[model samples]
Target chain A: MAASAGPEIERLISLLAKLPGLGPRSARRAALTLLKKREQLLNPLAVAIAEARDRVRTCSVCGSLDTSDPCAICSDNTRDQSLICVVEEVGSIWAMERASAFRGRYHVLGGLLSALDGIGPERLRVEDLLRRAGNGEVREVILALPATVDGQTTAHYLAERLGPSGVSVTMLARGVPVGGDLDWLDDGTIAQALRARRPA
Target chain B: MAASAGPEIERLISLLAKLPGLGPRSARRAALTLLKKREQLLNPLAVAIAEARDRVRTCSVCGSLDTSDPCAICSDNTRDQSLICVVEEVGSIWAMERASAFRGRYHVLGGLLSALDGIGPERLRVEDLLRRAGNGEVREVILALPATVDGQTTAHYLAERLGPSGVSVTMLARGVPVGGDLDWLDDGTIAQALRARRPA
Candidate 1:
């Protein structure tokens, strides 16, 4: 007898549909693709999911998902303890790691200070970051915040608050990304913005 | 203390890199995307994977994976028992189902007979299909095989063997898909070459 389409496949489709840029059609295609390649893809994927589920946990000190509290970076003696890189989200921290540009310890602010969304410093990990910094090991703070208005506001808020504490504050340079287009630049006497880039 | 990176994350990155269309960068991005959306996407995806791992099984009769053997189409009594549509793979079966054009039984050949790959009739589900057809309920067989040389060879072999068994054989109508063009034509041309379709 033909069996009814059951809850298991239905649940898988529903979860897959929730991914960014995926809808029901793409979800169905992906599910079927995974099903067809069960030996090479599906089995390993299942095992990976199980292992990650068992091992992943939130770092109590930094709120980054790690297997332990204080995470590896926070506990690493070789990393610069005095220099903290503050980011808006865990994803941004991962992006920084991929760039391999910064070796400093990280502090995830969870989100920006957004008045429209009613998000303020109290809603973030800013207080914890300040407390940790006040322990006197932190000497310099690098703000790797997004360039949005709320991000800039949050950066300013931290700079004003931490400046009086005698910690040097810096921001990541803002300009063109490593590979950006000049043709997309608008208007102008074009004479001014070109002169601003320095050999930092 | 900061712990160094471990083999688990490395294993995940390597495995994810092998997925279709995902390079190392996109794989890393996707992995982090899943992690950051854990409550919304990752956890539920994990749950679904676990559930599917426990429930999915191959149809003993057709070699298709489903929650039950003989699948939904095989078991449905209202579908035409006298007509069996032979297809190359489960993907084709799913595509046909999406069209909602055929209301009949399906016999998945698993693959076309390919000399280059040294695949033969014995390597396909041809034996199982023959056994099922010999039971005498089927009166018509539709060769919904691809129009590739191997696919045509497989279709011809089936027609030759099945002709003496007293059954009428048919194939899909010839035409571009409703929105498709001749520029996209390939294996499908064999079907399309059979006729110019009248506007329905």
Candidate 2:
């Protein structure tokens, strides 16, 4: 529907519609909500977005996003520099950080090597990863990519490349999740759990 | 989890988290997506929001949001000037516009009169509506408010106030929605639909 609220509000609605989960209807609702709480919400949100646009930068070493070049994780000396967890995107880095389980450094590959899409190691940061691994500091290069075909292919490729460099290559464990019910578990997950069963 | 992406990105995420359907996790993902496509998405979005903030204003006569003083709908001379649809907010105006059914003007009440929340007629545009009705131009005032208790109370109050002025006060019909499933229909909707049933 053509917006009766004028072009500026319409522009805001269209822009908000580009967000991950927001559709045109919800974007219109969000625009109205922001307008209703202009002083409290809209102004602050606008400022924050503008500041993020001006300041946010990708880490040159790893591909994580931050205001700084190397990012806070890469610059911090306390983190385990010997362990480099490889991921496909910056969002995975944030997810890993949220878990608070891994205390190692990260390497964002930008994307997986998809043969169907013609993406290869040249398109990704595989050369940078090999160089980092060859440098005597890193001992283990963890492949924290997805379980999909492209992810597996990329993992295998990386393992072959990093093997000669003396860095151990490992993938995330595959099994049923901790709180998952066996009755609801898919066949693939059940089989993996059976194969990876540990002693009590 | 604490954000390692720095304060600016964190600020954007927190602000985005306050949107209607987004939570902390989705907001973080949205932020990363925005940052990843900064030139294409984030910059334009920030500009749009800033423009909306600077230009959008509440129409003095109807309480609807617009860049102009009277809003496009309010100033349009082609619409039915004798019919005024009273709604609770600007979002409802957009919904009504999407239907492409109404050809009249609108009066936004800002919110319904909620006694439990201590809201009364004074806090709304009830006085402006009364003034507009008494101007001897409006022949009908349609209450397009929600079906909640507060919505009904506000409609009743408006009807009582406008009864002596010789202006017709009406409400939107309550019935089952056009494409609603009978099995999923609530008791209230079923009763309303049955009461309003028409002979084929």
Candidate 3:
């Protein structure tokens, strides 16, 4: 980011530096690449970003991000409306979708209940979830939140709230991963795997 | 890369994966982060990129990139025009400027001549350097190209070309880099450092 390269490029570099994994040096390199391949990369990327900005929407029903109001998953009739997978954040939903194991819709909690961070049940989408659960369409709600203490506490709170609505609440199994080696597995994970063991 | 993220977000992730250090996974992460921080990062970055694209201009005299025709360094009157540092690419000019050691202007050759890549003298800005060197105002031309074989070959070719123009030709000194460890230094660099030793 030298004065010789000019202010506009410098501004672009500084802005790119704020991305998740990029720092100043890598941002400068990326800026140079973008500048060098203007027609091939810069213009198209700018258009893509603008288009995403103009079209991005949050699903009112499931609290997921998409270009539509209800989101693709919520609007799609092929997905099981009777089953809902609850997550701690939007990123977790994407991760779950990547696994391709669940055919159900999703509800994003936005965040876990952290008393130290002042994130209470009210801070999450708990009321909306409860309302959806009581609508008589959902038969089961899967708590696919993190395995952390806060995640478990939020899941328990959500279970208690949704139990009265006649919907069965379940959680992700805590155990060793599919390809996990016992030597590599942590103490708590090994213990959970043993405790949750059942007939295959 | 899940389908639930929509086509627009997927396109953004793929395009971002083409950047210098970003891969497909990191690109998705970057896109999600951008989506979350729409106003703070996404919108401003898009604007900066568009501005940079609309304003960037290659320096007419020295071949560096800037918003102005002659570039900031070339247009500045205080810097020594008689001494010119010739580098292989625009990135090198920024690298030199960051050191704050040189008080002269720079000339970007655009690329080094690579036989395997079919890059010849005509592909580079050699004629521009020759013209600038023979302009009577310039007294010295420094070839600050890389230490690789191709870079040295290009330097030799430039020296031969600039010889008839009456400007004295010099090159960057070959020695150990500052703060570089001796154990990690290559044999050639150690040999060069020993040969270029100076009295204390």
Candidate 4:
């Protein structure tokens, strides 16, 4: 590979190919682009990745990664501290934030409970979430996890654990999502939509 | 974005987003995977990229990027130095190597002459290729460029310029590519294939 593609470039391409969504061909293209835009993009990107790798740490409070111990959201006192949204991963919090609808704190579960994968409640930050819920400041614990079996199982497990606490437990609304057509939606989603139908 | 996604992680995602074939969503995914496998991937990738950026240099003889002044191919003594394959970019050399058929030296033109893009022969390594071709050791110079107007124009220009060098000028055979359907192939390709039909 080095003889053909040059050792330095080939090494860069191999490492880049390990990135999610980048196959060997796309990695080659990305490597070429990086090489072409060295000063403007590649240098900055390399520095950024190194900085992130070294400085980024899990928020002690919310389990989200950030430059600081407690993430920006966890540190922000302006948001509703009484509402805590439980999520499967940090990405879920970002997605919810992108909607700009949820103004509350978040608890990253790290992962969902999966029997096949042997990921139990202990694997997740379930204890941390329970401790946060029982702290008296949080009024609600919304399970904004996926509708999948693993997600629901984890949500149920958390709800059961938090039952002793006085905090309100809720699940994200389930139905056909925005931009979803009735015919195109899955059977389960359609059924849920039908069950949760509201006046137009 | 930093407020929602965490500053350091968000910065990493934004930088990754600028990579070729990666949008915001895929960048987020890549960032997540990197954060998840920090020791295994993120740290090493950052190091690899920085090393490549710093150590990689253009081969003065053939214009290919490598750790050495004259790239591996250019320095190789066993390869057919009498023949030179003119290519548009460094990627073409790698692609040719993948085919394992071309055992000649390579002359990277850097880019093709494009009037629309305001790129002329002087902008490319046309003079460099001419010099290499006229060095008296090269017996033939093969134009393995694209079939586009700009590519063909550049090839014709090179062939005409190399005419005085007394070296044989040839082109890569144009035809229906292997596994390419005749029905899916364009009109120009079909005509070219018919004009250059083989005995088989």
- TM-score per prediction, in order, is 0.81, 0.95, 0.91, 0.94
lDDT of 3 by residue, A25-124 (tens): 8888899899889889989998999898899878999898898898989999999999999998787887898899999999998889998899988888
Q: Candidate 1 or 3, higher TM-score?
A: 3
| Model 3 chain A poorest 10 in a row by lDDT | A1-10
lDDT per residue as tens, model 4, A126-180: 9999899999899999999999999888888888999999899999999888898
**Residue-wise C-alpha lDDT for candidate 2, range A95-187, written one tens digit per residue:** 888789999999999999998999989999999999998899999999999988999999999999888998889999999888999999899
Interface RMSD for all numbered candidates: 5.6, 1.3, 1.7, 2.1
Q: What share of the true interface contacts does each candidate keep?
A: 0.25, 0.80, 0.75, 0.74
Relative to the true structure, candidate 2 reaches a TM of 0.95
DockQ result, candidate 1: 0.30
- Poorest 10 consecutive residues by lDDT, candidate 3 chain B: B1-10
lDDT of 3 by residue, B73-177 (tens): 988999998999999888888889888899999999999989989999999999888888999999999999999989999999999999899899999999878
In candidate 4, position A6 carries an lDDT of: 70
- Pairs of colliding residues, candidate 1: A2-B75, A72-B2, A72-B3, A75-B1, A75-B2, A76-B1, A76-B2
Docking class of 1: acceptable
Question: Lowest summed-lDDT stretch of 10 residues in model 2 chain B?
Answer: B1-10
- What is the Cα root-mean-square deviation between model 2 and the actual structure? 1.7
* TM per candidate, chain B: 0.84, 0.97, 0.95, 0.94
